[model samples]
Every structure is written in C-alpha cells, then in structure tokens.
Target: MTQIVILAAGMGSRLGRSLPKPLTELADGRTIMQQQFDNIRFAFGSNAQVTIVVGYKLEHIIEAFPEASFVYNEQYDQTNTSKSLMRALQASAPGGVLWMNGDVVFDPMALERAAALVAREQSFVSVNTAKVSDEEVKYTTTAEGYIKELSKAVVGGHGEAVGINYVSRDDKATLLRQLKRVGDQDYFERGIELAIEEDGLRFEPVDISDLYAVEIDFAEDLERANLFV
Candidate 1:
C-alpha cells in the first residue's frame, strides 16, 4: 500500500488569516486540502491511505475530512513543517509514501507522475523549472540529475521544489532517520538534503515544469493560485 501524508499543522500566519491554511477556501469553493484529496484520489485511486497531520484548529480539518486518518502535532505552535511531517511519516503505513504540503494546489497530472514514480519504487522530488522564485524552496541537481542541494537559498538553481515527493518502501526507513536529524524550526526538505549528502539517499528530480502548482503561503500566492481554478 502507498501512503499519502499531508503536513497541515502550521497556522498560516503569513497568509494573515485566522483560518488554518488547509481549511482556507480556494477559488473553487473547496478547501485546499479537499482539492489535494480530490487530486490524490484521481491519481492513485481510492485505496491509498491518506493521512493528514493537524494541530491549529484541528477540529476544522476533522470536520472537513471526517473519514480521513489524522495524526495530531501537539507542538504545531512551536514547530515547523519538519515536525509535522515527522509525525505523519511515523503514522504512515509500511510502504512507499507520497508526502505533500497541505496548503499547496497542484495539477492532477503532476501527482499522477509522482504516483507513477513511486509505483516503480523510485524516490523522487517533484520540481518545476518553468517558474523559479527566491521565496520558494529550490533544488539543484548534479549533471547526472541527482539532487545535490535543496533549500530556499539556492538561487540560480535548476528549479523550485513543488512540495511533493515520494519515498519508496526501501527508502522510508532511511528518510525517517534523516528526518530525525532535522531541527524543529526547519523545513522537511532539510532532512532530505541531509539524506542526500550524508546518507546518499537517491532522490532524483522529476520535472513537472509544465504542470500548474502553487503554494498558498501569502495573499499574493492565493491570488496566483486562483488562476488555476
């Protein structure tokens, strides 16, 4: 079974809203997390385990997704995506896992490609080279196409990471181990960087540059994301 973990524990203070990021209504009238679930079901079918990590206003998410499994992150106020992701990863079933940021809205095709990669037992990070931004997490790959670095500071990098990735069954343990090295204040990608550099965890870049995707972190981002609808 392939598990899908969504990190949605953080309060969207940057968005300047009282609503939790995942529960924020998109232009389509559905919440961001609902769109994610719809896309995931389209790509991977209905059988895959979809687990969400919730904290701030967790009840809203529970109400929104009554049937979905959830892992509570009690330290959401004190931690970042890394900690929320660790909780989700720990709760995931034993097998390949697809990890996504709950506040992001991406084209179904992008997730379909990610699911295909995971079905092949490949661990990969989705990237969009078409649009690169300084504020978004970026990735740099070696000439051979293996990820070398992943961080927001990687200016002039190959592409922006789309906040979606897959960890094969064989690599799940290694990824969890690497995630343990990440600090509470850091993004989960930091653990991926460490895994790539220190443990040689192979996370190839899957270019989905042509696909439409947006991380709704701010008002401007929400405006741009509306274009997708």
Candidate 2:
C-alpha cells in the first residue's frame, strides 16, 4: 500500500487568514487541502494511506476530511516542518512515505512524478529548476546529481525544491534520526541535507518545471497560484 502525508501543522501567519492555510479556497472553489486530496486520490488511488499532520485550527481540517488519518502536532507553533514530518514518519507504515507541504498549489502530475520514485522505492525531491528564488528552499547537487546542499541559505543553488518529496523505506530510519538532530526551526530539507552529509543518502531531484507549483506564503503567492487554477 502507498503511504502519503500532508504536513498542515504550521500556523500560516503570513497568509493573514483566520482558517488554516490548507483550508483556503481557490478560484475553482476547492479548498487547498481538498484540491490536494483530489490530486492524491487521482494519482495514488482511493486506497492510498493518507495521513495529515494537523495543528493550528486543526478542527477545520479534521471536520473537512473525515476519512483521512491524522496526527496532531502539539508543538506546531514552536517547531517547523522537520518536526511535523518526523511525526508522520514515525507514524507511517513500513514503506516509503510521499509527502508535501499543505500550501503548495501544483499540477497533479507533480505527485505522479514523485510517485514513480516511490514505486521504485527510491528517495527523491521534486524540484523546479526554471525559477530559483532566494527566499525559497534551494538545492545544489553532487557529481552524481543527487542532492548535496538543500536549504534557503545555499549560495549558488541549482533549483528550488517544490515541497514534494519521498523517503524510501530503507532510508526512513536514517532520515528520521537526522531530523531529530536538526534545530526546531529547520525545514525538513535540513534533515535531508544531513542525511546526505552524514549517511550518504542519495536523493534524485525530479524536474517538475513544466508544471505549476506555487507555495502560498503571501497574498501575492495565492494570486499566482490561482492563475494556474
């Protein structure tokens, strides 16, 4: 069975909305998380085990998706993606977990591209090399094209990580261990970077540049995302 996770624990304070960011509605009238659910079910089937990590205004998410499995992040305000992702990993079954940030608006094909890696049990980070912004999480690859440096702090970055990734069942333990070592505010990318640095974990960057992926950080981002919808 395929395992999928949606990290929806952050407060999304920047969006300036009363509801969770994932609950924000788009032009098509589908909430962000609803569209995400449709995309996941479209690509992975109705049988895929989907677990959502919810925190800020979690009741909104829980009430919206009653069929999904959920894990609460009590420290959601205090921690970051690393901790939210770690919780999902710890609660997941024995297999690769395909995960994404809750606020990313993208084509369903993005998930399918990541699904290819999951089916092969290979770890990967979905990336868009077309535009690498300084504020986004960027990456630099090794000689083998596996990820070398991944974070917002990288200097000469190759591309932006589009917030979708998978960790093979084989590498789950190592990545989880590394996540525990990162600071509370670090993104999950930091853990992946550490895994590559300390454990030699190989992560392929699947190019999704042809697709639309806008992570809604501000109102302008939401506007850009709605353009694709």
Candidate 3:
C-alpha cells in the first residue's frame, strides 16, 4: 500500500487569494486538489490511500474531499510546511508514502516515473535537471549521485527539486523521527536533509526534466501553470 500525503495547510498569501491554495481553481475548471487527485489515481491507481493535510479554511477541503483521509494542522498560521507534513506522516499507515505539495501541478508521467522507483523499494526526490531556478528548492548531488545538499541557497545546482518525493516503509520511521527533531519553522526538506546526513537515508534523484511541473507560489507561477494546463 502506498499512502499519498498532500500538504495543503498554507494560506498562499503570495498568490493574493483568500481561498486556500489547494482549492484554487485551475485553468481547466478543476480545483488544484481535484487535479492532484485525478493525476494520482491515473498514475498510482484508485485504491491508493490519499490523505490531505488541511488548514486555513479546512472546511472547504473537507467538503471537497470527503472520501479521503485528512489531518488538520491547527497551528497552520504559526508553522511552516514541515508541521503540516509531519502531521500527515504521523497519520499515515505503514507503507511507502508519496508526499507532495498542494500548490504544485505536475505531469502524471513524472509521478509514474517516481512511483516506479518506489516500487523498487528506493526512496527518491523528483528533480528537473534541465532547468534550475533560484526561486525553487535547489539541490546538489554527490559524486555518487546521492543528494549531498538540498536547499534554496544552493547556487548553480543540478536542478530544482519538484515538491514531490517518495519514502519507503523501511525509511519512514527514521525520516519521521528526523522530522520530529526539526523546528516547526523549517521546511520538511530540512528533516529530509537531516535524515540523509544522520540516518544514512539514501534518496535517489529521479530526473523528470522533460516533464512539465509548476509550483504555484506567485502570480507569475499561476500564469505559467495556466499555460501548462
């Protein structure tokens, strides 16, 4: 069983919208959450357990995704993405977990490629090596191709980490423990970096450079996403 966790707790104030980011309507007329669900089902099958982490107008998410499991981050305003992700991970069952950010819209084939690696019992971070942007979460790889450093501060790195990753059941406990040790203000990637550094959690880099994926953080990103859709 592969559990899917979506972090949707942020207010997305950068988008200049009152509605929660996940509920924002895409150019296709489907909500961002709906598009994610559809893409997940298409790539991973309908039986995959989808758990959404909601806050900042959680009622809208609940009403929209009644069939899916949910974990509420009551302190959404006070915390960052790390807290919302931790809540979802704590609520997940024992299995491979596919974690994604709610504001991202990606090609389904990119997920399929990542899922295939997960099926091989390998945890990985999705990256688009074709282009690296300063605004995105950049990453650097070791000589052996393992993620050596992952952060926005990395300059001229291999590529930007698309906000999607897979953690195997075997590595879940270690990753969760690392996540718990981090401060609430940190991004979940901080925990992931710690897990790699301390616990020897090896995350292979899955390059989906040819695929289309966009993280809708600002108005321009939303415009790009609309063009992609």
List of clashing residue pairs for candidate 3:
none
TM-score of 2: 0.99
lDDT of each: 0.87, 0.93, 0.88
What is the per-residue lDDT of model 3 for residues 1-229, given as tens digits with 9 covering 90 to 100? Answer: 6789999988899888888988888899988888889889888897789999988999989999998998999999989888888888888887879999999988888878987887898889999998888877899887789887888888779899999998888998988898888898889888889999898888999998898888988888877888877
**Highest-TM-score candidate:** 2
Per-residue CA lDDT of model 2 for 1-229, tens digit only, reads 8899999999999999999999999999999888898889889887798899999999999999999999998999999999999999999989889999999989998888777788899999999999888899999999988999999998889989999899999999999999999999999999999999999999999999999988999999999999988
Please rank every candidate by TM-score, starting with the best: 2, 3, 1
Q: Which regions of candidate 2 fall more than 4 Å away from where they truly are?
A: none
Clashing pairs in 2: none
Q: Which scores higher on lDDT, 1 or 2?
A: 2
Candidate 1: how many backbone clashes? 0
lDDT of 2: 0.93
Query: In terms of lDDT, which candidate is strongest?
Result: 2
Give lDDT: candidate 1, residue 90: 83
